[model samples]
Target: MPSSDAPSIRPRRLRSTPAMRRLVAETRLHPAELVLPLFVREGIDAPRELQAMPGVRQHTVDSLRRISAEAAAAGLGGVMLFGVPAVRDARGSGIDDPDGILNVATRAVQQEVGDALVVQTDLCLDEFTDHGHCGVLAGDGSVDNDATLERYRSAAVAQADAGAAMLGLSGMMDGQVAAVRDALDAAGHADTAILAYAAKYASAFYGPFREAVDSQLTGDRRSYQQDPANRREGLREAELDLAEGADVLMVKPAMSYLDVLADVAATSPVPVWAYQVSGEAAMIEAASANGWIDREAAIHESLISIRRAGADAILSYFALEVAERLR
Candidate 1:
């Protein structure tokens, strides 16, 4: 039955069945590779759902603990926490305060979860600053890099003191990893890890995130965040972070900057993570709501895309749901 013109090799046999495909799949997604990014607002007695992000919410401290436990039970790797303070000021004084919402939340989560999973804190002042900038401003109204480092140093110690296992240095400040690393080491927190947002870009996909944090910013962060046009700059930033002692390097807006993520991951000596930002999730949710796509399939595909692009871990709004499904 052999034909002279027929091809001898075919690839379809491997993909002909679900079990066959699963057996030979090159990339696999596991619940332990996902990290849930959670928000906690100080004044809310109840969790407040984010409109732009339908399924996500700004949770109360009590609610945060509940969901965090659920995440751990679901076998998710970790949870990254961001705080929305009841009141904000120019310097974001709340960031370093022992009784501040973020610090308090860190303590609560550590007590609740213990070592079940990593408890990470977002080490940025945007949620605590009235101006909604990642760092404090100079007299000229621009973010002051060195001055912000001073703030981050104290904040790093405070987060460490509160029992945060990792501090996500997401401010995009120069030498931020080194500064925070030094502070953490000096404060008897040498064991604490740092997750550096090494290649964060100024992108339109941050809109939903601004709403999530109740940002009061009037202008853009282009001056600090990497320009979207510069592909090489992303790799450069990753190198800088690695040199500065970052324990983990992250590329933000995972889908959009997958090339950058791959570049960083290819060379990084440590674990590389990626964030599936709010806008990315909102787009998928909106499309699914309109019945334009299969929601579950899309979520699975999107996450697999990120993992295939070389992220060791992913921070996603869908982490818990996806993790549950994987289980």
Candidate 2:
């Protein structure tokens, strides 16, 4: 037994210095472990800043190419692209259109930094659908999962043809991973990969994203997205995606779902990633803007927390800025 003057095991010795703390850190965030999510719009002549998400913007095709190149040169892992089209229809036809905004942006970025960065595109229809749903709506106003899978198959081919290194299936449609994977393979894009948004939840945290993507959704996405209360379901979703040929698995709204992220990461044979969703990022920025928290430190802490939760990669709006700091 130790006396009152000395502790049995004093952990403070290692915490005495920053260098010692760094040396013993179990989770280290690196530039390569960050992926930036960007938005590109069709008719915007110049990049327009998103009001809800302070520093993020809706980029033009030209701006996307330039920024993507910059991100590549910054030595970040990759960039995920979401397109805002000039028009939307019931079927979200733009998603599978070869000349659609997303495909066009993907091609442009591939040309600008093809081998330098892993170019990925959002494999979802919400931004392209006038109905503001992730899938095609049936006569009764329900999102048709099977019908949406067909559209995803078409979108997969279009994205792969546009030089996307990987397709991020964020639509939360069931069997999306298998459908997109088979679609890519059959379309002669066998080398292309799929990043399944396996544990996406219908969280209120997507508020800023709705604004960022110009989402037309008037109703909630509770029908397709997972319930936030279910931890077991997250693991089940991850397992399904794994069996369906997903190259990577992702959990959205990372901060609120660290437990799900950790559980998924624990069993995933492939890389497990998490999105520091728009709301999460916006909250930090908003608080920092009010001088409530140290901006840099908060961002670093949030990222490290996500990393400590077992994410192999973090999809963040601040990826570029944070990666620059990490470098």
Candidate 3:
């Protein structure tokens, strides 16, 4: 397709072969850049597979320990824990309970892997509140942002006490990062870091996650989660989190928000993370099961694209599997 007036430049030369492609690669995905997101539940003796998220399980305490060990041995960068409590309440008291599922899992994983992997826990109430909202309701039943910050503060301390190296503030309440950070520092957990879910959008892509976590929401999360239509708003959220002393900023539903992720990555002072949420993982798994796509190649390309989008780290369900392949 070259024209008679074409210059000497041949762009394809650098991509002509696998070796050349490797040599010119601008982005790389290493096992150490992947963080596995895990779910732990109370009163379960064996790991139960999440039907919506094939190949992903809600683990029991002992099983979670084994999985954490596997993550460390496989060289994953970290594990993010989400708890499934046996009971839920308006205040999400379980989140502050030292023996809560998430806290217990955090301690177990920290003990199991030691410094081999960074242990993180979801510092949110959605998974613990009976209403499945991130925070308590106001008098009129809307999300009470300030009240949520208080809960997050206590939750941060609990997670840190249970040995979480980092707490993921996913609630999206204003001032949450500052609340939790101040709480951690005052509780003598100065080394405990915070990963603010700065650009989390309320997307349809979280359908599978609702199943995985047994979320009890009767309505949508549009009240708190960012609207998908806002790009600059995402950047504003990141700026606010950074100002609040967040150690890392994260963009949720990575594939759909790569632009936001890239923007945050370019502007943020700390590490930027992206989450390949449950629906993304389930889509790949479902398509591969039907022979519609090459499973391994698709996952590699998806993750590579996220990394190329400027994620310093990725939290995904495929972390362990992809890590083994990378090794």
Candidate 4:
């Protein structure tokens, strides 16, 4: 303890070399641990860049195929597809239509990638509903939780039929996981898995996602999505999803909710995933574009920190870029 002059007492020794740094690194990021979240717009023949999120775009079916191919080639774990339909309705018919843009895009990507990458689709109605709610609205203009469960059941079946490997139920409606799972099994899509957004918080972080999806949300998702101030509630949500047979439980806006991520990871019987949502991505992009940070370095560090926190896989807008860099 008194060896002030000891050469071996220096803590900087391990940081002196790249190989040493690599050896001592506590967390490692791989392309296969990344899942890209993509948007496909109906009736759009061209890829349109999302203004709020720089470098992100809503793709056509053709563009989605190309992107899926690239994701597979880069060894990314999967691509989560969000549909931007040209029309919206109270019932969100587009979500259950076999020929709907998202379902079609899912099929196209599945054909293109050929089981090389997991094809996932967001099973939420917000992008397809005129009211911009994740579920049907009642007479009082409030989201109908029970009615939304039924819609989710149809959407789950439609997504599974469209060749989706996983259906992401991000709607936060009560009984959504169980309903979707039962629907999938009844439709003989026993292979299709459900990824539950178990601890999705009603945070401001979804602003860029709305822009990307061309959403017309009239009000906030506070009534359904978890309150940001509650941590124990997150665990309870995860527990409910688990009991309902969710294959994977996810936390949205990973960086701000690492505590919830850790809590879910600790006791989760299945894989625990995190979504590094649109606003989080935009903040990094905006800051980096302003020359405030090294884009690649900051992106890497952010993802590494998330991984270190406890996510088994991360869904990110930066997925492709990070995958390419990792490669």
Candidate 5:
């Protein structure tokens, strides 16, 4: 062991007190760095609570407006809207219709919150498709990548026209970012940004999300989404999206993939985001309800850890609650 005169460097000095910790904090999370993902189902006259996601609900257009207003008041970074259409067709016609539930909800939220909060919409067909796939299926029963790109192009333009400030490209289809970006620019919506779910993995964590959207997906997303065991592939996906003009790159199921999030953040040329998806939120809520853990503290700790791991922004189910607390 060392000589007493050797400079005693104690790292705990910064951890001694709350004020000291705050003063020396390496990473901090703020309300502006969090985006709330909201679900609005068509034909619902009132908010319907999701059984799987205890505190979350499928809201009506009016309820969406009210919630969006609260988000703006809480100073949230943005709101990502998912629509549960009452009807689904082979071509996902609802996705491109100006009167589509998602488009309608986007216009309502924009009118309610204006520029105070960024109003974003989920630019995907899974919720509107009869097959429950993110894209069109080929004659061979495989997902037709090219056809899906065409659908995404139309969806992006429609969302822009409906007042979406940002488009969340959640479908893991190849060339999606480039296709949607081109469509937006061609339609003179160059200012509309794309949040690419660049490294989304095929995991069971999406179960609750499927339930929330009333998805009828019969098969796994392994054919499109990345493999859970591959880290290098995740980086490659992120790199490709950035090169394709994605304004933000995201990794899904944030808690289980903090390593991937950190890797993406370290090398990404743009902002890196993490989605704390439905299953992750459900697990915490279920455990807390059973008195297994302190819900509030656990939630804060989980979010803080994600922020410390290099997430510039987070799409969390707890966004509203956390923002309210912070405010």
Candidate 6:
């Protein structure tokens, strides 16, 4: 009915229906591209739900194992574990101890999953340290980077021995990836993969995470974690980690740093993952609870945006539920 001068090209036809839109969708989320982050507290009789993060819990070891089995059954790509010990020390001695809650849970989950999913450990001291710093402190109370590397070396060997398929080096200390890689290789754990938190930023989004882990931090981590204002620094960190033998690189607080994630994914030969941190998920949960948004749709959109922004895998609290839905 249109004249020759009228527009004939129609992009709307592709979006005319749900099936049509899905058929041409550029980004599709799959269960294999999701990883769940879980917390296991030592000496807990039952799972303690996190108040700030609705539906998330600091699980007992038994509950952790059960959830890990469920994650594997849902066909999730992996599960990242964080352990909260009942006791804390200045040096975070529990981090590398074989009897440490983290190590023990790692063994249990790896045993339960058994090649069904990758079992990764958080290689940091913040959860174990009384002061809540990622590294050991010096006499001046400043983080001792070189000394922390030594501790990370020990922790790397311990985690590998405990059956962690991947070690998420998230401390952001200089030369951490290289040091951990060397230590793992020397300890005869050459096959153990390293997932470097290459672009972790000092963001307000980490507030809820402190509650999830029962963090003891009194001051900010600006000295070690990257400033949220720097965009180029993210790519630089990813480059350094890659050169230092990282099998996977991560950008933390996924939705907020999609640019950094896309930058890293554009050039890195290794897999690129992003973490949908506690605050990001918390906002969604709160909004959904208040009936301000559709919970399921928002969750899917948030994850899909991260994936479209070039995250090869996403570490999200929503992983298990999303994966089950995908299946």
TM-score of each: 0.99, 0.98, 0.97, 0.97, 0.96, 0.99
Report the lDDT tens digits of candidate 3 across residue range 1-327.
988899888899899999999999999999899999999999889999989999999999999999999999999999999999999998899999998889888888898996899999998999999999999988898999998889898999999999999999999999999999899999999999999999999998999999878999989889899999999999999999999999999999899999999999988889999999989999999999999999999999999999999999999999999999888
Model 3 TM-score, all chains together: 0.97
Alpha-carbon runs more than 4 Å astray in model 3: 1-7
Backbone Cα, N, C clashes tallied per candidate? 0, 0, 0, 0, 0, 0
lDDT of 5 at 20: 96
Q: How well does model 6 score by local distance difference test? A: 0.96
Question: Where is the poorest 10-residue window by lDDT in model 3?
Answer: 106-115
In model 4, state the lDDT of residue 272.
92
Q: CA lDDT of 298 in candidate 4?
A: 87
lDDT of 2 by residue, 1-327 (tens): 767887668888889999999999888888889999999999889999989999999999999989898898789999999999999999999998999999999999999988988999999999999999999999999999999999999999999999999899999999999999888889899999899999999999999998888999989899999999899999999999999999999999899999999999999999999999999999999999999999999999999999999999999999999888877
Better of 2 and 3 by TM-score: 2
State the C-alpha lDDT per candidate.
Answer: 0.94, 0.93, 0.93, 0.92, 0.93, 0.96
- What is candidate 3's CA lDDT for residue 167? 91
Looking at model 4, report the run of 10 residues with the lowest lDDT sum.
Answer: 1-10
Rate residue 150 of model 2 by lDDT: 96
Give the per-residue lDDT of model 4 (tens digit) for 1-327.
Answer: 767676767789889999999999989999999999999999977999889999999999999999889999999999999999999899899999998999999989989995798999999999999889999989998999998899999999999998999999999998999999999999999999999999999999889888888887887889999899999999999999999999999998799999999999999989999999889889999999999999989889899988998999999989998899877
> Under the 3 Å rule for N, CA and C atoms, how many clashes does model 3 have?
0
- Those runs of model 2 whose alpha carbons end farther than 4 Å from true positions after fitting are 1-5
Give per-residue CA lDDT, model 5, range 14-115, as digits (tens): 799999998998877799999999999999789998889988999999999999999999999999999999999988999999999999999999999978
- Candidate 1, residues 1-327, lDDT tens digits: the string is 888989879999899999999999999999999999999888888999999998999989899999999999999999999998888999999999999999999999999995899999999998899999999999999999999999999999999999999999999999999999999999899999999999999989989988788888989899999999988999999999999999999999899999999999998999999999998999999999999999999999999999999999999999999999998
Which portions of model 1 show Cα errors greater than 4 Å? none
- Cα deviation in Å at residue 234, candidate 5? 0.6
lDDT of 5 at 272: 93
Q: Weakest 10 consecutive residues, lDDT, candidate 2?
A: 1-10
Q: What is the RMSD of candidate 5?
A: 2.0
TM-score of 1: 0.99
| Error of model 1, residue 270, in angstroms | 0.4
